[model samples]
Target chain A: MIELYESQRAMRNMRRAAMQRGVVAILDVGSSKIACLVLRFDGSDPSDENIGSLAGQSGFRVIGAATTRSRGVKFGEISSMGETERAIRTAVQAAQKMAGIRVDHVIACFSGAGPRSYGLAGTVDVMGVTVDEQDVARVLSACDVPDFGHGREVLHAQPVNFALDHRSGLSDPRGQIGNELACDMHMLTVDAQAIQNIAHCVKRCDLELAGLASSSYAAGVAALVEDEQELGAACIDMGGGSTGVSIFMKKHMIFSDAVRMGGDHVTSDISMGLQVPTATAERIKTFYGGVVATGMDDREMIEKGGETGDWEHDRRTVSRAELIGIMRPRVEEILEEVRACLDAAGFDHLPSQQIVLTGGASQIPGLDGLASRILGHQVRLGRPLRVHGLPQAATGPGFAGAVGLSLFAAHPQDEWWDFEIPVDKYPARSFKRAVQWFRDNW
Target chain B: MQPLSRKSQSARHDPAPSRLKYRFERLKLTPGFRFCIRVVLPFALSVGAVSLWFASDDNRLAFNQMISEVRETVESRPEFQVKLMAVDGATSIVAEDIRKILPVDFPVSSFDLDLGKMHETVVALSAVRDATVRVRQGGILQVEVVERVPKVLRRGDRGLELLDETGAFVRLANARADYAKLPVIAGDGAHDAVKEALALYAVTGPLKARLRGFERMGARRWDVVLDHGQRILLPETKAVRALERTIAMDQAIQMLGRDLTVVDLRLTQRPTIRMGEDAVQAMRSSNTIKAGGE
Candidate 1:
């Protein structure tokens, strides 16, 4: 828990340095690929005077981008520190070369480590004066920090909503006349070891770790349209080794969770079922993958060429329908797990139920349709918003995490560190406030 | 005992609906609408105040005057005062011209100086192609300018002025003799057509010494006036190519030196030449003798 506070402070300091430098790198370390994007800031402080108009929109532009096949990473967690460091170095170096500027600060996002979310509420008397930053800080400090067991730490503790004087859902309450101030904060915690491993990996690459965000939150920020974010939406990022699910409302990620299964599971299924190599299975999946099969698929034959000299095995062909059959069950299981996560998040309680699917694995045809049927929400396929000077090849769902990290680097949400947490007020366990928050929001 | 037990059950069931009704009544004012009121009411109040203030002339004047006074105090800080101005990326003459055009007062507060307006004023100078004005460290106002490079010298009714490559007015020439190396153009609107004249002069590389100037004809075409009072009329379109053809013909036939007053290449396919008056009369008399002999 102390480490959480330290990491938050370090991240804030690093973010300030990156902003001063006018350029920073955004890295997405996933199971299948490590992507890096170099963003150039135009020196406009995002918090300058237009807080109401430019709430969630960022002002950074991508100047360079590069990606490489990930090594020593599985389920979005670093398995081999040395291998992951090498991959990150390669990606960042390539991106820096393209951008013609070397960057020492990087903000990285990953998905894995059994993300858990807790909602906490805090309230305080405004001392009969107009509410200001200090009051907001006092209220935030009053929120009870839940006992998230051992070996886990908070990744994101953001004030999702604020209420003043019995009125709720206030975005910002400063400069307003209020006698009482209340806040609902969403805290996401992940495995401490996973975060430490990533920090170590980034340090090994000789770059300062500026910030860290959950890949699901970053993807949702990048892919979900403004209305979807404002009303309510969920972004399900299906990567190679993990599926990240995040729920957003009012431009804030209120809940996030991840399932340790992704496209690699389907590829492994195909590899085992067809007795083919993983590379061949991946090729076949990318070229001919689908969740839904039709009668026409039965007539379409996919050649399964083998390196062995055995004529019978090398010359064999299988119907596309058979491939679809092998892939659908695993895909359905992943979606079912995602649905369970969403149900646990009380997604149906939100006013809007739009779900956006994005990530390298989400590129599979018919996934949106299948997701809509399974998740019982309006589903849409999402790709990252095109940033300035981004290459044509980099404008794909695979780069959503990288692009989203860039946006996060530019215009990070006002987090707990952004405010001065009043040191005198310690968190007190108040069960009544928690229940009241739940009732009000849900 | 049975009647008493039945009475307890009936009493317990009777308040259930009323309790539900109480809960519904409590929930009538949703947090969302309350939040809306909380945000909208203050915003609307401020807007109303502003509109009312703007609607009344006296109030508006008082408000604006108060704002200006506050701004003046904040801007008059010693750190915000610009003590010096430095000009870069221009010659001494052009820089002097830029200084004259800019409306900045020396040692004035930086806030009082509208940098955007200053930039526009500097760029409006004939010599300045682009300019950037910024407050540098140490309260120094830095003005960086890209001065236009003169490509041609045009003699106009307003005297000689230098023209850049794009035929835009640059600055008044200090002396015509100083820019003698540059090709000179004259006549109305020739300043705008300096580009075509320059191109024609470029292709006539061998005839540079004999070429004097270009006269813009009807503000459309060019009449290439040479040193020996000989002129070549060039068409508007492809005037460069026509000049090139004339140069080629001159190199082949020495057509320019053959006592001709005008060479018309307007119809590029058939060039017509008007001989000198004396030369035309000599040819006519010689033609009569040749007819008698036939």
Candidate 2:
């Protein structure tokens, strides 16, 4: 049952096993930081009526957490492979030491390249009044596995919708009475090599690869409010190495995209423009970065330290207006590129007008006004929601994706799990009927 | 129950021993089997015939008696009626007009009343797909039918017609219904092409209801119009997707205002708009020529 869905099977089984055994570990392998959290599933009450929250029955409890600054990674890719392997080992070791458990299976989340989308449709026939496991298997088998691009393999092909006879847009069509059942699935794919790289990193850390998630999608799960998710919303996560954009509708991520530049670029701009060290530039950005400048800022000056160890050079100062003039353009360009991406996504057609900005870069002062100007909508800064035992330090926008990954690992979206596998094919083709597809798949 | 009598006992077992005796007696009649049996068998058969009688055609075989009674009732008159002329492919044509078109095909005779063969003959014509002709009790024949409607009106090398979603071509000239609404597709090989022009209209539920025509711009794209005068431009790769995006965007931007003239989804994410006179002018130039032509 656990191995039925090709992508998330192991993770689902591991999560279930952890719940039965009372512990699970979640790992987030991001460019800026590597995060780990040990969760304890309290499934005695899976029903939400006792929880008093709109968020569906969340039965997981986090016991221990640790995050280490990531090293040996550049542009969200493994540049120094050995250094990356060592970094992952250090993060997992430190997390294990704190949790007091030798965790085996770890669900990982990462930001990188080679993200693609495909639409696959499968059909199955209903032979009786009540749709059984065989019916579910048949419809899943009938899906037309599209010819995804060469050199790329599918990572996630989950059924997004189901149709029964003349009725369509059914989220679940299992119990309905109809002669035919069809499903339209949206599948996400990534570069095979990128997946293998992450898998290798996890395997070297003495942990099994339970699952993988796009960084943008995980952050959206943590950042977006319920209404925003239902009507449609975009999450712009400005991480240290990359800025990820994910669009959600009907509480599911329909599109996930990332730009290769983010908060680090802003720090680099400040370092180059002010002729200061990288550390000092980061401080200045944290204290005084602004996309919009005030009239009084021209007279106001910030004390800048010189590169050398000379007292006279350390006394240098630059006007705040000058810093704004230097920083505003780069921020504007990033927003313009984001606008281009949104236009590419055809964002103007969404039903709502809300945009949530989260991440290290999004924390900069006046970035909201700048984003609203460029994205052309209502914009707000997003912070990670409070979950059981989430550390105060790990609750910031920078840790949104990591925290969301923890929650996601604990209670994943049950996508293709209910689709009982037929005897014939794991990825069923469109030509087979439901029962025959199930027979062939199983 | 009465006690068994001698006659009753004989009646119960009468045929059993006789059947055995009959088989045994046949063994002794070798010479008589050919000559004597032939003479005895005819006499036995005549005796058997006199005991049984059978009726044929029930009591209705007395029609000869009824014909003599009918002969005294009315004066004789020659059978006369108007002729029916049916045009090929006009399966739904009325029978009264057949006399006006070709007045020599129908004749007033009881033998000529079977119109099934004639109906089949007309339906065999290239212009006719199906038809039905029936004769009434008053000697007047009436016809009612349903004709095949052309699916698509195609124009490229020469004017050819299409039927159904199969994209099959109809060769007959002027066989299409008068008020039937069919799209005119134009391109190099668009005679039977099932591309974006057809798909864009097929997906959008509300838009499909008001579709007026489609103009194929080569094999790649389409520009279409709704009956209420809304125009749409669809892309090649994800035509259905582009349509869905357009619908979502329309709800968001309220771009499909009552005065909207054109909605374009060709540019990946950007929706180009044309309104007022420019939209009307563009629509007229693109859709006017090939739309309602005969």
Evaluate residue B222 in candidate 1 and report its C-alpha lDDT on the 0 to 100 scale.
Answer: 93
Candidate 2 interface RMS: 54.2
Error of 2 at A283 (Å): 1.9
**Model 1, span B1-294: residue lDDT tens:** 124453554334222223344234323333555566789888999999889779999988998899999988999988898988899999999888877777577789987788888888888888889989999989999999998999898888778888998889987887878998898888878877877888887887888889888889899999999987899999889999999889989999999979899999889888899999889998988998889854
lDDT of each: 0.85, 0.68
- The CAPRI-style docking tier of model 1 reads incorrect
TM-score of chain B of 2: 0.38
lDDT by residue (B20-84, candidate 2, tens digit) is 33233323333456455678888888877744422434334455456755653332223324244
For every model shown, what is its TM-score relative to the native structure? 0.57, 0.55
DockQ of 1: 0.00
Q: Compared with the true structure, what per-residue lDDT tens digits does model 2 show for residues A80-157?
A: 555567666666655655665556667777766656666678877786686766677777777776676666655556
